[model samples]
Target: MLILGQSPTDAPVGTFGLVNLLAFLCIVPLTVLFAPVGASLAAKLDANRLKKVFAVVLLITGVRMLAQLLL
Candidate 1:
């Protein structure tokens, strides 16, 4: 919405690209900080239970998308 809403205002191309670049830059430090924490959490979760949790999440998201498209 920011991009589309601002596009009509004559915001410069470089401004849009800079925002994109800054957002992308945020990922590097975040991954460096969270990767070890995520790995430790994953190690504590049982594989089969984790798989079932992911399956349920996917199923719910899929159903929600289908509902949105249909209704």
Candidate 2:
């Protein structure tokens, strides 16, 4: 929604400006190179383990957001 709501001329927030675009461009090649490796590793992981890992990631992300809000 943020992307759709934003106009081209809108001031860039830290994640949505020209600098971020350049950074994304720079990382695209690396992402392309490593994504398949990541996919293979994920594919090898058991479904239950993957779900637990994903849950932990989400839990950590939620805690970080809560910390930021409190701080």
Top-lDDT candidate index: 2
The worst-scoring run of ten residues by lDDT in candidate 2 lies at 11-20
TM-score of each: 0.48, 0.61
User: 1-71 in candidate 1: lDDT tens per residue?
Assistant: 55444443564444462245466568888999999987887788999988887799899999999999999
lDDT of each: 0.74, 0.79
> Residue 26 error for model 1, in Å?
1.2
Tens-place lDDT digits, model 2, residues 11-56: 5554563345666778999999999987997999999998898899
**Clashing residue pairs, candidate 2?**
none
- C-alpha RMSD (angstroms) for model 1: 6.6
Candidate 1: misplaced stretches above 4 Å?
1-19, 56-71
Collision count for each candidate, in order? 0, 0
